[model samples]
Target: MSEVKKIATRDSYGNALVELGKEHDDVVVLDADLAAATKTGTFKKAFPERHIDCGIAECDMMGIAAGIATTGRVPFASSFAMFAAGRAFEQVRNSIGYPHLNVKIGATHAGISVGEDGATHQCNEDIALMRTIPGMVVINPSDDVEAKAAVKAAYEHNGPVYLRFGRLAAPVINDRPDYKFELGKGVILREGKDLTIIATGLMVSEALEAAETLAAGGIEAKVINIHTIKPLDEELVVTAARETGKVVTVEEHSVIGGLGSAVCDALCAKAPVPVLKIGVQDVFGESGPAVKLLEKYGLTAAGICKSVKEWY
Candidate 1:
């Protein structure tokens, strides 16, 4: 069997920015002294004149991005998820989100996959923060292809968008010809009637693997990849819930207010099925290898399968 290709979504974000820059003259990129880490340095190298380094001040960078958007220029403010979504919460909520500017927040190193960076840098709560800001479009792409497509889609959409990218390289799973990238739609990767596995970000690939494991045990599992989390494809989620009669939400974020919470919120109002949320259990991450952290936190495919079997 051929080895699966892997690429970090952060790299995809940078490469996509370079492509967007070439196509649109008004597409500008701003970084809070994390050009290399956030991969916006690639855009800087390609378009030196258009890329702005706003020092280490994440809040100031948000304000600058907001100002740049006023001139009809699309600015993608790049930074670590901790500073971009946590530290700059006020600016993002007021300046960009309140006025509804055409600014994109490329928040790289999201979730515990940030590895040795520890809890301070690992932003497991960014999705919840961004989702609270009314009108903010939250998207957490699963792999390279989805991340690149999300960048272009965010550029096309005329509003505030918060994009979460991972530090660890994930397998390229959506490279098939039938793949499509809609801004607010979920993709059904595998069809089954026993139960539904709704996942986002890196968990999408893991969900597929867990589905295979479940199938081996004669427990068919439907897998849905929700790349866009804000205007969550609630319709797809609801329909899948109604069909499968049970749901399991998986993500790399905290279970408090992330994908799991969003899924519960939708299901409660519409479907109201039994749910098992698999993610960070509302605790801070510690310094460790990225892969080990995932294993310890029960975010891997084997962990997911174990959880599903116990819950079911």
Candidate 2:
């Protein structure tokens, strides 16, 4: 087999922004003094006129992005997850979400995988916060290909959107030419009859790896990649719940209001199957290496496999 590719989703978001800027003149990029870290510097280098650095004021960036959106320009406000989703939440709600403006929030360094940045910098609740906005479309892409496609889709979409990105260099799982990304649709990566493993963001690849381990023990597991957290593919989730009778949700975010909660919510009213949530258990993050943090937080492939087995 060929060597697997590994790239950060934030890098993919930056490259996608550059490509979008080249194709659309109305595309504008804004960052809160984190151009290099958030990777919006790529767009700034490619299209300096369209990219704007808003200093360290994340709330001000949201307001400026909203103002630019009012003029019919597609503005992507890039910032760390803590600043974008936590600090500027009010601006995002009133300025963009309430008015239904065309603004895309590229939130990078999300979740505990932000590592040594510690608890304050590592935002594990961005998905929950974004999902609360009425008109905001929440998207958490699994890999580079999905992240690129999600950026284009968000641009084509004509409303408020929150694109969650990660800093860790995760494995490129959707590198196949046949992979196509559609907003609000879950991709079934592997099929099985015993149980279903639903995952998003960096945890999607981990779920795939766990599925392989489970298969070796004569436990066939289905893996579903839920890139879109809001406007969730309810049909697929309900079908999987009913077919498998057991569901497991894995994510790099908090299990409280992230993918796991969303999955349980979808199934609670419909299929009502036994669901196990595999993520941070409503706890704050700590300083550690990305890989070590994942293992400690029960976000590894082995951890996922163990959780599934225990719940099974």
Candidate 3:
């Protein structure tokens, strides 16, 4: 098996947001006083005037962000994923989505990746809820390059954008800026013809590893990096199924409404392949290390390998 390369997406967002702030003066940052934790500290340090520390009020922060965006400024609101989705969901939906404001929601500490913070802090159903909002663009970038591109894309694309990042470092799976992020396109990380593993966020790297593991077991699994969850890659999902008879969708999200459901909807409605959804099987996270949570919930590469091995 190949060694997993881990890099937190929160840091990627923070660094890329600074780059964005440097590129454009209109790029503003709104944090719920969690600058360093959410990796928005770099932006705050670089552009003090553009940083709005809302002092722990996630609801107010979302509203403030919407108001800022209404003034023709690009506001990237930062907070823990739990507060961003669970605490301020109504504010986010009404202020950002209903009004169709140009706000970029940079949700940090996503999934079971929030190792020690426990179930209360971790957000597995966040993406599913965010995706339900009409005109909302939900993105889960798998690497630094995608993080940067997603930042720019959210800024350029005139609508509400929700981007989730994790606390724990995951693999920097994406190697090139060779591709630009289309609002609804899923990128192919690895191509194969036996079974397909459609994945998003940190799971993309794991799915790739799982594919390799399956190959050694005489199974060739295709891997799709589903960075965009809302406006899913219908073409790629159908295409992957056509190429491979079986599908295994992975994410650090809920098994029900997250990437798994999205892929299954596409595959069942169109391609109609045998799909196995791997994720937090409809349960909240526990107070433990990320590796332990991943292992407990079967989100790790070894777990993915086991799932594919069963089918093979």
Candidate 4:
């Protein structure tokens, strides 16, 4: 196996925002002090006049973005996931979500992959918090290419959008010469009949690798990448469940209310099957190397393969 190039999704979000600024003058960016960390600094450097620094106030930033959206201008508000989604929960729920404003919340440093930040900074519940709000489009792209495409999609779509990005560099799985992204649709990367592996965000690549290992063990596993989490592609999920008769969900978030729970909710309503959720087991992350944390939490390809073996 050859080495694959890796890039953080936050980098893609920043570059994409800059491109959007060049194309659409109405596009504006706002950051709550951590522009460089969130990678919104790339857009700020390109469009200083359009960029607004809201200081360290995450709630104020959300409100300002909501206000900006009312004037028919698109605002991309960025901050760490813990502050943006967790701290500004009330403001986001009322100010932006209630009105369904055209504000894009670019939440960086999501999941336990935020090394050295520990549980205080690592956010594993942003998806659960954001998805609970009505009319909010939730997207967690898997890699650099998908992240860039997701930024463009969020800008085009009206209403509130929560774009979850991570700090760790992820393998470029969707780096195809001709790769197109469709909103609210799940892409089937590999087809199999024994079981289905549905994953979102960084877990997509892990799921793919797990599929390869499972194939070696004579267990054919279908791999599906679900970037859009809120309005999940029910048809594809149901079809996969119906065909495979067994399912496994993988995510970088907690197993409670993230992708795993969302998959179970969809499957339980339509096709009942034995489902396994692979993610943070309802525990806070501690300070450690990101790779080691993933391995400890059983979020790697080997861990996924082990879970499959146990299930079978």
Candidate 5:
């Protein structure tokens, strides 16, 4: 069997920016002294005149991005998720989100996959923070193809967008020809009638693996990948919930206000069903290998299968 290709979503973000820059002269990139980490440095290398390094001040970078948007220039402010979403919350909520500007926030190194960077750098709450800002489009791409497509989509959209990327290199699962990237659509990867596994970001791939494991045990599992978390493809989620009857949400973020919470919110209002949220259990992450952390937090495919079997 051929080995599966893997590429970090952060790398995809940078490569996509370079392509967008070549196509559109109005596209500019700003970084809070984290171009290398956020992979915006690739854009910097390609378009030195367009890339702006705003030092370590994430808040100031947000304001600058907002100002640039007023001039009809689409600016992607790049930084770590911790500073971009957490530290610059006020600026992002007021400057960019309030006015509803065409500014994209490229937040890389999100979730516990940040590895040895520990809890301070691992931003498991960024999705929740971005989701709270009214009119902010929150997107967490699953793999390389999806992440690149999301960057172009965010540029085309005419409002504040928060694009979440990860430090971990994820498996490329959406390389098939049938795959499509819609701004607010969910893709059903596998069809089954027993239960539904709705996942976002890196967990989407893991959900597919868990589905395979469950299938081996004669338990059919439907898997849905939700790339756009803000609009949340509620129709798909509701339809899947009604069909499968049971729902399990998986994500690399905290269970408090991330994908799991969003799924529950939708299901509660529309299709109420038994739900099992698999993610960070509302605790801070510690310094460790990314794989070990995921294993410990029960974010792996085995962990997911174990949780499902125990609950189901």
Candidate 6:
């Protein structure tokens, strides 16, 4: 059979919002002037009344979303990652995060994946921003299937959530129709011993490839695909760390405040190991193709292999 078919998390969010709208009348969508770009246009078209386009006012939209949630309504505020996390930090923190409102924040165009939109739109620091906030459930689904599952799980769970997705297409690693998600749980795509590759979001597929390459090169790598960022599956990570002596973390976001940092923090207190983080270093992205940007920032499978060769 062929390897898994790649699809972006944006496509999954678009479809899942429509599906959620069908079941819950109180499920509303609030987009901060980027419905089409964020792929929330489908929800607006399907449920016009429930969809609120809060044009260009990200900070304000977050407060309004919190208000809606306080009224026992589920509001999924959609926008680009930079605006949602960086631009609207205070509103999201005081209104939603502190109060612990049941609001679902969908931040699209995350990481260097926005490509041609350049560094201005990329939200590589969002993971660090959102993950730092208290009472916030941060998650980055790997592909379409996982994104769909995440949306459903977020809707059912009663609390504040930040679901980040990329602008580019990523391979679909999951195909389970009846998949049930328990927050803070991760999946081991392949088991190994020599080293461990801990990855999330778009990097999961690349990590899988890196692991395969490592095995072929006589280096067994245990691959842990962590779909959820906050409330992270520390148990799985600890187990993996203990199993393997060397470790590497990969993500599309920045090395400081993204998946790698979270993994490192968890692994340090619980189970420390030699960790090499594979992500964008202290630099902003330029306007280029998504794949080109990823390659330039040392985020490809080949990059992972090189890091392992040097670090481990």
In the range 101-124, model 5's lDDT, one tens digit per residue, is 999999999999999999899999
Q: Which 10 successive residues of model 1 have the least lDDT summed?
A: 117-126
lDDT value for model 3 = 0.88
Angstrom error at residue 19, model 2: 0.4
Reference-based TM-score, model 4: 0.99
Off by over 4 Å in 6: 1-4, 176-180
List, residue by residue over 1-312, the lDDT tens digit for candidate 1: 999999999999999999999999999999998999999999999999999999999999999999999999999999999999999999999999899999999999999999999989999999999989999999999999999999999999999999999999999999989889999999999999999999999999999999999999999999999999999999999999999999999999999999999999999999999999999999999999999999999999999999999999
C-alpha lDDT of all candidate models, in order: 0.96, 0.95, 0.88, 0.94, 0.96, 0.90
Relative to the true structure, candidate 3 reaches a TM of: 0.96
Clashes of each: 0, 0, 3, 0, 0, 1
> Model 5: what TM-score?
0.99
Clashing pairs in 4: none
Model 5 misses residue 163 by how many Å? 0.1
Write one digit per residue (lDDT tens) for candidate 4, span 62-130. Answer: 999999999999999999999999999999999999999999999999999997889999999999999
Q: lDDT by residue for model 3 over 167-225, one digit each (tens)?
A: 88877766655776777798877778888889898888888887888888788878889
Poorly placed runs, candidate 2 (over 4 Å)? none
User: Comparing candidate 1 with candidate 4, which one achieves the higher lDDT?
Assistant: 1
Model 1 stretches astray by more than 4 angstroms: none
- Report residue 233 deviation for candidate 1 (angstroms): 0.8
* RMSD to true structure for each model, in Å: 0.6, 0.7, 1.7, 0.8, 0.6, 1.3
Candidate 6 accuracy as lDDT: 0.90
Query: Each prediction's TM-score against the native?
Result: 0.99, 0.99, 0.96, 0.99, 0.99, 0.97
